[model samples]
Target chain A: MRVAAVVKRIAKQFKRDRRSLALMMIAPLFVLTLVWLVLDGDDYEPKMGYSEMPQPVIELLDEETQHLEQYKKEEAIDLMKDGELDAFISIEGMTPTTLLEGSEPSVNSAVMRVIQESLKSLKTNTQIEEPTINYLYGSGDMNLFDRVGPVLIGFFVFFFVFILGGISFLRERTQGTLAKLLSTPIKRWELVTGYVAGFGLFTIIQSVVIVAFSIYVLDMYMVGNFVELLVVTILLAITALSLATLLSSFAKNEFQIMQFIPIVIIPQVFFAGIFNLETLDRWIQILSQFMPLTYGAEALQQMMIKGAHIYDVWFEIMILFGFALVFFILNIRVLKKHRSL
Target chain B: MSFINVKHVSHAFGKEKVLEDINLTIEEGKIFGLLGPSGAGKTTLVNMMVGILSPDQGEITIDSTKVPSFDLMNITGYMAQSDALYQELSAKENLEFMGSIYGLKKSELKERIQHVMKTVNLLPHLDKPVEQYSGGMKRRLSLAAALLHQPKLLILDEPTVGIDPVLRKEIWEEFRELQQQGITIIVTTHVMDEADKCDELGLLRDGQLMAKGSPGELKEQHHASSIEEVFLTVGGVES
Candidate 1:
């Protein structure tokens, strides 16, 4: 009964503070859209400059490259230095040598693909058939946005819920409401449960809105069940909420809550499958195991990108549940500082 | 037997002692004021009585039940020094939340909320958000919340710091009426004139109880003109 009162009060507070509600619902969508606009572009077409090439070779290279230009050795080097050319190919001792302007990895790969394809045909002295490309999971049409979309969904849900939940709990202390609450007959567990159920409702709605918008409006790649995606996102949110309330015990105010972004939130993004962690040191890869977002983002990616079923990602789901439970228990323990009972 | 017994209670925060070896008692149906300046541990001592804080070295009991107990908390109403209200919530909403936490039934809570709001003279502005309320109005609302559950013991810390003189007197009248109904009230204040109104006063200075007595008895015992002079006399002797 006491928990119900707390939940109802939080609902009323959210209704009155429309701006915070909007921030939790709309801010993630805004950032996701911006990222999509920047990352969803077509693959890069590198500009290639060649000199002293045979007529037959020039024709073959012209067919392979989109922006093929003829230039003297000196002029091609000048263009490459000026950043106008991606690569320059010239024959030296009857062997083709290539000079690449290699700042961006993607652009470098694109240039190599074009040069390698034309040179392969030249070296074989016959036109070889293209190998049939097949995909076991995501198709060839998947873009950078599709690959990182699930991770972003997980990240935003975790980020916003953490900030909102942490600050609200901290306010209860700084404003003396927490001390006043401890004076009442309410039990410690009841208060913590009230916070979880209260914030849990909003996070459910938040998960639904963000997931629907990403799949329907933004056309993000989704090969999994909508309901399963929501399950992962909501569990991730609960984990974030519990962790946030637990940490709020140590913070004195809102700015201190924000200080957690660098120390807590950002590192998870790097290790949560948004970036490649396989090439990192073994110890660095092991660090990701401790972060809750790593499990959430991993589960989300498996479901959305690999089209895995709920049973397939049960391990990740259980890990997230464990994190929430541990944090929730710690929250109740932290309240013992205010009132031992 | 005394209604409230604070026996050998001593508390410290980190290295600074806030209350030291304090022994005090209050009868049922009396207005007991803790008279002291700021940092005199008045708030700390009252917090221990309300179960918000546990004494490091001693035990406090109300009606023979040790405090820091849920049963005692259910019967005690505490008004903190800070307003401690949800600024975005209306006065009605804040009272309703607190009333329900005390397990007040729906119909009874509504009636009690209205009664308490009337007692504090804030009935008309009950629906107004607390953020819009003036400082005095917020203090009154906090008092109304404490009174909503109809507790037998009321512990108020500086309840009238921002209220005007006219309203302060009116509040004191309401306190008397509550006392008449056999409610035990504990008020902490530095106001000398207000100390004279209590049935008993515990004069505290630097975390020590310099003296404890009825306002008249304290003055006569020290051969002082008023409770303020008595405070200075006892405080001077201790120093």
Candidate 2:
């Protein structure tokens, strides 16, 4: 009966909040559509210019340029120097020479890739050297989304869960229900647990939409199991929920909760395994190790990019769960300050 | 028999005592008022009586068991000063939730919800989301929720603050009807008109019960024509 009441109330609240309903249902779709547009499209089209090139080489140059502009060799170099064009190619004595204007790695790489592809078709006796490139993820075509997908997976889970959970709990305080619940025959754990269970159920749908949208709709490179990604997202949501609710104690109103986002949720993103972490100061790197989202994003990356089985990332999963558990216990203890029972 | 006995209860937060050596016995069916100013610790004392807060000393007994017992929570309804309705939910949904938490069954829950909503005259707006409710409407819905389970004891902390005069009178009439039906009520208010409506009153000031008697008795004892003057006389000389 008690759990039913919780579930029913949760369902009612979910239904009444059309904006949150839109948030949970539409936000993921909006983001996924964005990711789809971002990842599925062509990256950085860099214009290539060739002057006084061989007829066959112009064919090669045409293949390399997104849209080419013909100019005299000197004028092309001038354009390149002035940064009007990305690069200019001029054939001098059968040796391919190039002048460059360089900025923005993606643009630079886009121009370079087409040049290389156009050159690959030629019959040159030059030996192609393949040294060694070890990749833990998709080799080169990994777009902006693939690189940031894991972080975004953790980000949306944390974002919605934090705002929803924090604001709802804050509402409970403002509405006097928190004090009223304290007056009940309820144990301190019951209120905390009920909230977790209620929001936990809601987060299930939220996680599914977020993860599924990122993976299938956005076409983020997910070489691992779908269930594993779901697990990571769900666990991250729980951690976010706990942290939000626990923080709600310190926040007297909605604005205070919003005040927490820059200070609390935003900084965690820097540490959420998005950037390559090896070069950081060892202390800062170790500090990043403490944030729950870091663990969640790491486990997600391992599963999504490395295609590791759950067993390989089980410890990270457990650690994320541990973060949730400790915060939940702290929330239960904190309620005692309001009501001893 | 006394349905509730609060004996020599001295509640304090740290060294500042809120209710000093308070003693009161409430009969099973009557309306009791804890009349005091804003800072008189009415909510604090009531919190102890309901088992939400424990007194550093003294005991509040509900029936035979101690206060704060989970068993007692089933039989007592608490309406806090602030409306406790979930703004995201409709009025009916809020009442149903409060009723279910108190362990009312489906049929009983439905019956009590209708009954209480009718009592507070909120039946017309049952389906609207509580966030859209006006201040007075919210107060009415809150009162309806406190009356949802028909508890043996209803502890209301400023239950009618934002309600209109006409609705306030009507709601008080319903409360009186409930009292006649053998439900014990303890309402707190700083409003003098509300104090006059209680069967008996405890005038509190500065963490002490300055006087305790029927409204008429309190006024006559203090040689005052109005309950407000009775309050000033008792609160001033005592302080």
Candidate 3:
């Protein structure tokens, strides 16, 4: 019953603070849209320049490169230096030598792909059949946004909930409401539980809106059940909320809560599978195991990209639950500083 | 035994002793004031009485029940030196939230909220968000919230600091009305005139209780004309 009052109060407060409400609900979607615009573009077609090349190779290269031009070797080198040409190819002693701008890794790979495709055709006299590709989960059309979309969703939910919950809890202490509350008959666990229940209600709605918008409106890749995805996201948010309120016990004000961003939130983003961690040092990869977002983002990726079932991600779900439970207990323990009972 | 007994209560924060060997008692149905300047440990002592803080050396009990107890908490209302209110919430919402924490039922909470708001003379602005309220109005709202649970003991820490003289007088009257109903009121203040209005006053200086008595008795004992003179005389002797 006491928890209900706290939840109702939080709901009423959220209604009054429209700006924070909009920030939680709409800001992530807005940022995700920007990321999609930047990441979900068509594959790059490198600009290629050739001088004294065979007609057969030129025809093949022409088919691969979107912007192709024939120029003198000096002209091609000048264009490459000016960043106009991605690569320049010329025949040197019957073997084609290529000079690349070599500044951008993505552009470098694109230029290599066009040159390799054209050269491979030239090496084989007989016509080669194109290999048919098949995907177990995502299709060939999957873009960078599709791959990172689930991790970003988990990250934003964790980030926003941490800030909002931490500050609100800290405000309770700084404003003296917490002292007033400690003077009341309410139990310490009830207060902590009330906070979780209160913020949990809002995070559920936030997760639903963000996940649905990402998959349906933003056209993110989703092969798993929508409801399963929400379960992971909501669990991630609750973990974030509990951790935030627990940390707020140490902070004196909102600015101190912000100090947690670089130390707490940003590191989780890097370690939460937003970037591939396979090639990183073993200890760095082990560090990801300690972060709650790592499990959440991993579960979300398994579900969205690999079409994993609920049971497949149950371990992640249990770990997220354990993190939240530890934080919730620590919150109750911290309240003992104000009131022993 | 008196209704409230604070026995040998001494509390310190790190090396700075905030309250030293403070011993006092108050009977039921009376207004007792702790008079002190800022950092006199009036708030620290008040917090112990309200069960928010525990004394380092001794214990406090109300009506024979040791404090920091939930049962005692149910009957004690506390208003801190700072107005502890949610700025985004309306006056009604703030009261309702506090009332529910005491486990007040829906109908009773609604009725009690109305009664307290009316007592504070803030009924008309009950729906206005506290952010729009002036400092005095917020202070009154905090008082109203403390009174909503109908606690048997009310501990108010400088409750009238931001209020104007007229409202302050009215609030004192309200305190008296509650006192008439057998509720014990403990008010801490530095205002001399307000100290005189208390049924009994305890003069605190530098973390020690310098004197404790009724206003008239204190004046007569010290051969002083006013409560301020009595305070100065008591403090003078101690220093």
Residue pairs in clash, model 3: none
The best candidate by lDDT is 1
Highest DockQ against the true fold, candidate:
1
Clashing pairs in 2: none
DockQ of 3: 0.87
DockQ of each two-chain model: 0.89, 0.65, 0.87
Give me the displacement of residue A223 in model 1, in angstroms: 0.9
- Backbone clashes counted, model 3: 0
DockQ rank order = 1, 3, 2
lDDT (tens digit, per residue) of candidate 3 on A1-341: 88888889988999999998998999999998999899999989889999888788899998888889998988988988888899999989978899899999999999888888888867676777878999888999999999999999999999999999999999999999999999999888888888888888999999999999999998999999999998999899999999999999889889999999999999899988988999899998999999999999999999999999889989999999999999989989988888877
Candidate 3: give its CA RMSD in angstroms. 1.5
User: How do all models score by TM-score?
Assistant: 0.97, 0.87, 0.97
Model 3: fraction of native contacts: 0.86
lDDT of 1 by residue, B108-165 (tens): 9999999999999999999999999999999999999999899999999999999999
Between candidates 2 and 3, the TM-score winner: 3
Model 1, A50-86: lDDT tens digits are 8887777777778766689988878888888888988
